[model samples]
Target: MWVVTGYAEVSTALTDRRLCKDSARLRAIIDRATAARLDGSRVAETVATDMLNSDPPEHTRLRKLVVKGFSARRIERLRPLVQQITDDLLDAMVARAADGTVDFVDAFAFPLPLTVICELLGIPRADQRSFRAWSTVIVGSSSRDDLRRTTTALGGYLAQMMSAKRSAPGDDLLSDLVEASDTDDRLSPLELVSMACLLLIAGHETTMNLLGSALLALLRHPDQFAKLRTRPELLDAAVEETLRYNSPAPVTTWRYAAEPMTIGGSPIATNDIVLLALGAANHDERFPDPDAFDIERQSTGHLSFGHGIHFCLGAALARMEAQVALGRLIERFPDIALAVPADELRWRPSTIMHGLAALPVRLGR
Candidate 1:
């Protein structure tokens, strides 16, 4: 595996057609590495067939079919809904802060985005809690048994949900997808299930981590936090800076070299599994004092959401979510502060995601 860390090189690799995201090719490379022909489980294989694992025109088609559900207009319409959710969650947090402390991760960060995505997908409120456990294992676990178990569970749940949507369609994203599949065959059954899984996982996981990491960064840097509170207009810049400083998605999903190429003057052979370190590239010499957490800095061009064609489809939604969640949190809880020492916090164990395991904050401080 080749790891590309330089900003310029990683940026180049993101768009270069020579690097591909075809899952079959990736599996072939893995098979060669392990010296065995390994067939993934049905659930695993179906999940891997999402747009995130395909190349154009397959990726292009899949993205087109799903992008309408997350259009700018749709996301904009969701702001009021997002604000309501944030306010409700904050009310609960205030109620729970009788002891003056609350785990922001549980109280606000995780549920805010999760609720939005779940509602958009028409998932019942009762079933929303179970997703946290399934998502944690799907993204963070290293054991094959753990992964298989979690994916099977998630996939089975989605299959049942899609089946229900087919019989009685609802005014939800999943129903629209089901209609598309059943009407024109634009989406196969496996593809529909895989896409739903992708939307459920990717829709909330990255945004959840972004909220946690953003709060952690602000709390750790009092000056920046104060600046945000005083000059509320800087909320967007603050979110962008947090994305560069501690990107939720630290590294991108795997990319394979379609042909021999040189990135950062290093030779990458065909079929080499390449990992682009978004976190590292964001801290590279491209920006002045890249290590400094300056909300006022020109933090544009950061590859936290990635670049080129494969850039995150939920970028607009995630940005709106962070801005709304953080802006309201600071406005409401002016006395919020870290409950424990900054160094005492621990990040979840995941190579691809950067997020705090827990963010204990004194809401009344």
Candidate 2:
């Protein structure tokens, strides 16, 4: 295991040209162990649509295409949509909670990101269910068997959707990617499928967990929750704090050394699996007052969305969605409390991702 103790070291590891993280090479190692559980046929297989699966020129190309759909200007415009989704979910929670009890996951955490991504991607109403199921397996697959079946099925789904877009392009991210791909063949049929899957997994579910993690932390820290409730404008830092306190995907996508490299004074060998601990790096004491959830902590940068050229494309969208969702969730239901004890809420058992299994709560009497 590669140890990274400082922000500088992590940053260097990410941007360093010395390190290599070609997706296929790393996939071989990852699937080697998990292949028995995932289909044996896919044992050496890599995902078709993942950004983490590419290197250099391809990485830069795909990142730029994804960025086109998520520019700061575009994300700023998405604020109203984020707020609208927040309001709609809170309203539904109120309607469902006639007696003042609601599963916060259903009422808020799940729908907010789901709706926003569906709108952002311009997924047809009819195809939403397929996307949802595909997303769950792509991002939330419970077991290896589940991952394989879903991978094949979702690949087919994306291929079919791309064909539809080719005929009748809509005003969604897929269409944008298609148009961009027309000029640049970086997004081939396989890559197109991979990109679609990447969008849903990265663009949707992770944000759901981001909002959920933030809400869960606030509820557990009632004093902090109260402070945020009183000062609604502190949302940006609050969201960043939650990301630090409880990283959604605690371990980033696994990376292996392309060649022998030194990181944090350790000589990592070629093909060594290095799991970047986003949660640990965020809490490094090097970053003054690492644990105190200060709402004004000048949250300049964090690895919650990741680092380097392969940084998250949906980051701006994720930030907007979290700020709007958490800010309004508190504003609308100030008394939102966990139906179960904080200790009883189970965390997803996945080794890579971290999130709640369920988040039931009482909206209030």
Best by lDDT: 1
TM-score of each: 0.98, 0.90
Candidate 2 lDDT over residue span 1-365, tens digit each: 56564677776677776565666665566666563433434321336435666777778777777777788887887889888778877888888874687777656777777777877776765665565566565556467677777787877776777888888999888888887777667677667767777777666677878877888888888888888888887888899888777878776666778779888788898777776777788888766888777666766677777788767778778888888788777777788888878888887656666777788888874
What would the per-residue lDDT of candidate 1 be over residues 233-295, giving only the tens digit for each residue?
999999999999998999999999899998887898989899999999999999999999999
How far out, in Å, is residue 349 in model 2?
Answer: 2.1
Which residue pairs in candidate 2 collide?
49-194
Off by over 4 Å in 1: 35-39
Shift in Å, residue 103, candidate 1: 0.2
Which numbered prediction scores highest in TM-score against the true structure? 1
- Looking at model 1, the pairs that clash are none
lDDT of 1 at 99: 88
Model 1: lowest-lDDT 10 consecutive positions:
35-44
